[model samples]
Target chain A: MPVAKILRLPLRLAVHACSGLVEPLRALARHRSLFLLLLRRDLADRTSGTVLGFSWLLVQPALQMLAFWFLLELVLQVRFPGRIGFLDYFLVGMLPWLLISEAVMRSTAVLNDLSSLYSRMAFPIVLLPLLPLVMAGAIFGMVYIVLVGLLAGPLAALYAPLIIAALLLWLLPLAYLLSVVGLFVRDFRQFLPFVLTMFMYLTPFLYMPQMLPEAMQPFMVLNPLADILAVVHHLILGLPVTAGNWIRPWLLWLVLLGPAWVIFYRAQPHMREAL
Target chain B: MSVIALRGVGKTYVHYEHVLDRLREVVTGRRCHREHVALHPLDLAVEAGEVVGVVGLNGAGKSTLLKLLANTLQPSMGRLEVRGRVSALLELGAGFHPEMSGRDNVYLSGAVMGLTREQVDALYDSIVDFAGIADFMGEPVKNYSSGMFVRLAFSVATCVTPDVLIVDEALSVGDGIFARKSFDRIMQFKQAGKTIFFCSHSLYQVEALCDRAVWIHEGRVREDGPASVVVAAYNGFLGTPGGAGAIVPADAGAGAAAVTHADPVAADGAVQPAPGAITARLLKVEVEVDGVVGRRLQLTTHRSNLAVRIRFVSDAASPVPTVAVALTGTDGRMITSAGSLNDQRQLLRDTNGVTEVTLSFPRLALLKGRYAVNIYLLCERGIHCYEEAAQIAEIEVSQEGLEQGVVSLPHEWAGSVES
Candidate 1:
């Protein structure tokens, strides 16, 4: 009897953890209208009082891309191994990076910012982390359309949607994990921007992977973000892709997502008291 | 079937001295914070088509129970089941964006209340008309007055009627006219056979609207029964001397007699006496019918005598101590007063010991309604009240004659209107 009870405990925990993944997806699908409304409200609120409304979304990434373009390509004279121009590489890499960083960074304070909504209303709490993810996706989609039109041809632009899906798939779980952690840890928000800056340097945003030293080149594969950016660069700029390039980033994302999804699902019920 | 059911539901909040302490507690799995049981485990059930009112003092866990039922707060222990879609109006204008116009906010607020865009579109004009802010719909909500903001929020919230509605004092918004309209709309919801969980300090509304009432005290359910019974018990508890030391007296001696003060009255038409703190403390205030102590004194038009007994303990010797009792009408007007100084009686000193005073009224002449008695221990000439209890005891009058105003006057109709 004791052995059976002990064995059942593990099975029960496994079932509960799996349900954590399924419950949020079910809630999101059921409350899709509310999710869309929140997405719309967040977008409208961001640009409500500004002189230039939706254009500010485009202006920000445009300005960042130009600054990096000048510093890395023009001033430092960095070059890729292939005929890929530095601007195309930077644009493709920077856009998804912005989407990922903004999603993670904004999610760090999303729970606190919407604490009143959680405490006062009857809406599903799982959808809150998705708000920033969807908002960042919308911003990325707009910027991606413009950059593809200007830099890449219309045929190459067709790959933008698939890239977005990949970026969202990677960022969503991270958003959920960080949002739950942020509710408990107050220092995460204060320390996030610095960590993101360090992470950007660690990734191949400003330069290509081959630009690094021979010893450091192989280590770039450990950063899933670098792998994702390399995949985007190859897809958008028609650069050659290595065999392991596609498998490594996806494997890393799956590895991160399983724990993240379980932690987020387990943390959802306790968030009400924590807040 | 019960629409809302809870079994041994409890919510305990861990309070940390600092935010870092919370993070440390979570990380190290060590107890670093104090736990506050916001609500103790209890059981309750509300069947469908029933409107239940939750009455309690400010920190009595009424709002906590409502939030738990609304699913905003997860109970730390116990099982709670709320069937069907539950829409809560916990705070008015909670999700309204100030930068958005009223038109846009109506849609956003509707969606927050679980209404779809098509639903909001269908009820758009009706919401605007119900809010009575048609012209201001184009302007930003920030520009709207607080009343207008509440009106729009309330309109949008009620437009989408759910199976269960939970409101926490949101109907006390807007002017009296709009409040009445909002209340009428709530009644319409009740007529449509929806379950409502309402929390308010207004016992009169609870008595009038709810089928049952629950009184929460210090995070526990103290009493729960039919609306009238629970409200009466709550009023008796409030009126009982030394029960609630924190109830502030209604500052009624501001010389504004015409103002309609909204004091909470129980179902039996007896106001909850304002419990005040004074230099001398009132020990007990009791009513008697023919010298038998009772909760209520039943009186007829021209028969039956009523007596009120007031007991107090003074701290120091008061020179020329006088006891006064004034009957205030439902509108907060002083209908009549009897004081030792006004009667030109001899002054009494050395009022340190506990003393009891009894005032009797032969043939109670007031009309059929609730009336409050304001008691005071004053110095000579009624200059200052050394001890005061405003609206301390209530005297309910039942008159057989048809008299509309405060008191009845003997008369006969001689003239008649001719067409």
Candidate 2:
């Protein structure tokens, strides 16, 4: 009976616990050149001879900030007077969301793009997904610098550094996970774009959770990106940092990731066969 | 010690000769197809450090023996044991990625051969030098020509230094200089005392490299012996006499030979031989694999051991003629064929006498396990046969799993690949 009980428990809890300790150590020990190779290949395919390779990373969130400013200020005439003006407040919110989306999109084709690599030889599937995930964060880091340096007012200096750093730390594991899931399911390529669309509207990306439809508020606050995005807004805009934001997403992340990691554990055998 | 052992190996494949048979199975309540047995039951063994060459007509189970050893296919019956690590090149360079560079492919190739990352890393520099790809290790393999790809793959494969190496006809390791290098490497491996098992149609190569050989006809082994014996048998069948013209060897001691043996009187009122030397010889011998007579030869395998059987009819008339027979491949390569007519010095006395000789093997030694034996009859001047059979006897080898070599040559060779 005890054995049965243990069997009934999710395997994700064990796999994630091990992965948490092992992953960071492994990443640090890897050759720098391999990581550089992965990053370079991805960048070359995406930006070959384009007008702006690095700028594309910066411009997306900046464009969102511009859209929000016009929509809230001119169309609806809404107001949230604070240490920073409306446009600056929006940029702070948009940056982290942009990073999260980029991470998800990069992972969508993690397996499909590597199908040729798979048939040709045996590959360490565990390490490969990390490439796209790390590159996502790297692109985010590049964009984050220009904003904080060129545009962040003196108040922006105080909390922006600490808040964005914390957000990125949480994202590494999430991005790695999504990459693997996208690889296993055939529907992910088509279904994910729609899921991303839904996840965005459900989170407080456009408006505060208080202003959201009441019944949806709990799910909205529990969104993994929501609490982190709120922390970023609070740090840059000087909103009350004690709102019911931080604890909920952190708890939800821990719960969801435990089960997700188990699914990844089960997927390795099938992945090798298909690859 | 036996390096390879087998017990009761067999294979049966049901084929639907007509398209309708396949379609009916999918839709009908019952399946309708005829079962075709490719290989029959066989039991055999190979000692460690022995080089064995397999010879048979096409479909005589040559490749099947190699495939079974490599664990590529599960035997229908019996068990096989291959001691130590066996590296198989059933298909040369099967897993090279076009987009990955040659250096990257070394790791990839090693993994397919069951080498780990760290192991390949330790041997990386050596593998690169062996492939002679120092100048092109960084470029994507797709850009490399077929010759370059083979060089890189062969380099990585040979560098691993496996305990047992199983090679198909992939011996044309590369072009020109690379081919020469590859040939030297194979010979080097042979000198190292590593066990080498190979199958090739080049009799000269097989004779040169293999000490032992096996001949397979219609999926069964006909003979296993020294390369010399097998090669001669294969050649005999190839140049066999054809058409309806018959060879009737002469009798040398029609009256005098018989008188000395105590049965001095002839049965057909012919004179008996006196005491002393009574020299008689076989004028010619002919054999066919499957077709009856005067039909076109349709051979399936090209192994050196298994071919058509020949029958001899001796006579003591004429000039006491000598007789011979042989088997050969469609590409001028010999399987299992041999006889003595012109090579022998003795001549027959009675030219009107007729006798019959039949050639046969234990089991068909082919993988697809099929071949047509060619029957040839030759005298001092011309050829002969009954009605001229295309393929002699349609034989099939039962593969229950005990079969060891593809052609099951009687003899075996010993050597190692360059480490």
Candidate 3:
């Protein structure tokens, strides 16, 4: 093969990733009012007719956390061997997990569900995949801060916004990839919830990492989400975490970014016709 | 420079047997589906302020061309550029959410049209006023009547006049009064020197409103030029047998001729409708010229009296069907056609759901040539075809004097000859 041809794939991948990351932000800036209207409409659609309206976002997660606290702390009276209490660990881990799972699950079907909005008009469909991330981010980001403040002091709570922002950025590539997959392969959306449930079990959200069987413990490094939670625990709870924990998720993100973005950009022309 | 231009742009829809085949093609970089060419590659350009009208039978790919220019559907091949702001009423209320309030839908539609919040705010009052549904703006659109919905949709579409306006059959919106109001609004847009592109079935409106007309036949530009000439050609084509090939009744299945049954059977040997099958159907059509009854007749231009008798069977459950007859020259140009719908006369039928209508013309003025007669049974609205029997009879006309045109014009010259 010629040298230029050999370099062409990587060159195009690099170009796509660079443009993909910036194009959405540019589209957002250009269509700020339209984006805001859609966001408002999305939020309203979820909470319309409810007495609490938008506050349900905060209340729903808080209620789930309370149920978990009741089961672990009050009912079972479980204790962890580490410096972190079982209740605090589960609470902190569960919030981020909720945010990630909600965003990912919704992202898969967002394009298909809202195809009517852009199908017959000249619309910026790229804005749709980002909606789930933004909505889920706002809901959990507020609750994460309050939970951290209640457990570890206000000083530790300051990292909540940064952590949520980082998680959203990490999810960006996955959101774009899964959206295209879900639209083209409709069966993927029907099976996504089970996959997410299995992922939740694979990650150490409900129990300590040390509680895993010896053989399975070694493979925890393979899951980037495990690495992500480890980093989150290290930040807010000051738990011991290795440098690899910090490097793994970011490395995975960088590796998948180019392909995911190129896939999404290439699929855009077909999106109008997909539905 | 042309405000709107297309260079060999066309659309081909690839139909996969299953949706996953599309993904397979993307992954494997191989063809996996059948290709339907909705439009062939064609070139076109329009000046900055031209009112261009598109006319074609249903399914003639007129909507495909408009959608491509409106930036809704991406063309499968070639380059298309439409400069300046382009607003399309391709479908009225297409952006509306039935669950949303009318007020919110207005803003939503405005946003979809790329209007900023402040721009929408400036135009909100005029839009609401024009639609005249201020009292119902708070309610959900699902609760609104069809008229109210179209009124609001049409109002929002036209309130913000863009450089190029694309409309599809939106001129005849709402009731008679609102239709006139919408027509006046379109006239205002034309007077403002904005480029307008619209497709409508009413050829009279197309001739009156458009400076240029494009007649698209089977996804190709069959004719493109001055409005009157192209419309006349299209109108002439509509009178031919093959012109109605693309038009199938809404409830019709499979083929175009399936709607018309050949002849119904009756126990007493009389023409009667088939039970449980209630579509309006043609029974018999007879043409007579100068006291002679036959399928073919010979007549003189100034002495022939032509008459046509048509019998049809219709269901009492459906509205009375209208009768139309056409006379066409050998070249398929419709010399003239008349319908009872245009006369606004109700056709009476017996208790057996059968009616016979005869149309007569005294002193036939056709100069010379063979002419074919066509009969049609249409729905009460006169738009939908219930049944059609094209070229059922033929007439040959002979003229004594040298007249050059298709018909003889009644004239008397008062000027003295310079001898």
Candidate 4:
């Protein structure tokens, strides 16, 4: 059977919720070695034994971004405002977008992915999705560290700490919300990639939000990725980010994430049975 | 004092289907519309530090009772209470994912089972050792051998130091080595004085492990007593009239087959077939060929992945539950009996429960043979719950050499005699 069927088995809301975990509460405190072992297991499981397994992680996005750039820059002759190489423009947005989207979207499937482990041990289901986010953010952190510490612009040097903090802040809820909902509906199995695609265009991955029509800019700014993208431009390019870009989008980020926090909170009670 | 107590405990679950049914029910305000009444307000009492083996045909409310004892299911109508920490391995690894490695399963499933991170950390080395998947821990279980998988799941289940441990028929699988290890671990739990409620069809395992036994047929318990007595009664029930001898109404299902009569007499008891019985039975179960009166048969209905089939005779109007077969030994200690009564059976439950014939033989794997068998039925009038023993009847075995082993098992033999 496909992986989808196995993830869908525990539909009993009564069992999927709180009471189901009475026997296995030790997953909360006693099992640190188990946690590390599980973390190592997750890494080994997804990345080993396949052709170009871990390497594919790097090759996949790098190829995707380069393809997009070559299509626009070489074939279509489209250019960033200042004749910036297509690579620079695409990398500036796609890199963070990849990190953010993968971090947020993939987080939802963590619990679903480890159904084998969670079902048997009575461990914490919350760790399923959260572990992936931590991994993604760590990967993102390394990337950001390289770009800012070694090769990024003078602006990257100025706002490095702030960018890291904001990214971390943005990531916490992103990882949490997707995970909780994943347990309930696993809607991400299909819609998550599409959301990432939609977010790609909305957040200036290919072009600045300002490049679009004025009417559309507000909608774009409503996205957290757009706010972060605009901030990235400001930090790395030394370009000015307008007050409307910052405030409105910040409010939108808060709004987008507010209910997600509540969802994460409400879901803990029912998580064990579902896991 | 009883650590576990129940009075009129019952459980009802709604059938679940696709998303559409769920949504429709949500909109129409029909909560769990299709109710599956599991435990029918049955009463129970178990003292602390006692090992109780629960015997039941599948869906006879065995899992329901375990889950309810763990508070995973609250009673719908009766008061129930337990004053201790419970560690249930019910459907061990109920949430394991093959994609994850054995190690992760240990942590994730361990946590799900109630081991705090620190507790898991402390027992990490021991858990890994117990799973015996030491090398495969870092590898995903998708690649694990079946034996290895069971080891990991079992270790994680028993890792937490629990006050009460509930084990299902987990060891029913696994290699002999792993089974022995698990058996030892369970024995250790016994020495430590943790209350254990073991559920399995293996009377040998139950006899070896439990001090007392409770047998359930249908959703109600039929017998509860010392291991020797209840197990003997259960075996007697399985042998002859217990199964395969059910009667069907002349107008039940379309194209109904004609009913057959039970045999006349056997070693332990006599078989008497009543006229106007609803159904027929054909069996070849191996009984105590010429063993002493007590411990006549140690029938362990081989737990197969195969489905089960069973037959029984019921009175027309209503059927009640009854029986207490006493197996008298030739020399000494009373070995066992196939009782129709056990303490676990809430005899007064199921006042409104179903009265259809139940067939429970695991996937028709029982070896065909000509063997002696016994029968007992608890018949009740229209509405009451307590039932009277129908008849302690006997029959001859006819199924012969269809398969090998005490109960037919799915195995292959590959050795050839030298020419």
Two-way DockQ contest, 3 vs 4, winner: 3
* The candidate that achieves the highest DockQ relative to the unseen native structure: 3
Candidate number with greatest lDDT = 3
Error of 1 at B79 (Å): 1.4
Residue B286 alpha-carbon offset, candidate 4, angstroms: 12
Please tell me which model should have the higher lDDT, number 1 or number 4.
1
Docking class of 3: medium
Q: What TM-scores do the predictions have?
A: 0.74, 0.53, 0.77, 0.62
**Alpha carbon deviation, residue A30, candidate 2 (Å):** 6.1
Ten residues in a row with the worst lDDT in model 2 chain A? A116-125
lDDT of 1 by residue, B1-419 (tens): 98999999998887888877866877999989998888999999999999999998888899889989888888989999999988777777777877778998887777666777788899999999999999999888999999899999888888877789998964434654465467667768889999999987756558767899999988999999999999888866765453433343454323222212243212242332222222344456665666665543456656767777766554343343567777765444446777777788754323344556788877777778766667676544353344455665555678776768767777766668453
Per-residue lDDT over A11-112 for candidate 4, one digit per residue giving the tens place of the 0 to 100 score: 433233333232223432444455565666666666777788766555666577568767887889876666455456566666677777777766778766
Q: Order the candidates by lDDT, highest first — what do you get?
A: 3, 1, 2, 4
Question: Native-contact fraction for each model?
Answer: 0.53, 0.07, 0.51, 0.38
- The fraction of reference A/B contacts recovered in model 4 reads 0.38
Could you tell which candidate, 2 or 4, scores higher by TM-score? 4
Error of 1 at A181 (Å): 1.6
lDDT over C-alpha atoms for residue B311 of model 4: 25
Regarding TM-score, does 2 or 3 come out ahead? 3
| Candidate 1 deviant stretches above 4 angstroms | A1-28, A73-82, B23-30, B170-172, B240-242, B249-419
Chain B TM-scores of the candidates: 0.62, 0.55, 0.63, 0.55
Candidate 4 per-residue C-alpha lDDT over B264-314 given as tens digits, one digit per residue, 9 for 90 to 100 = 223332233223232212221122222312212223223322211112333
Give the per-residue lDDT of model 3 (tens digit) for B184-216.
Answer: 687788889999999987565587678999999
Q: Name the best candidate (by TM-score).
A: 3
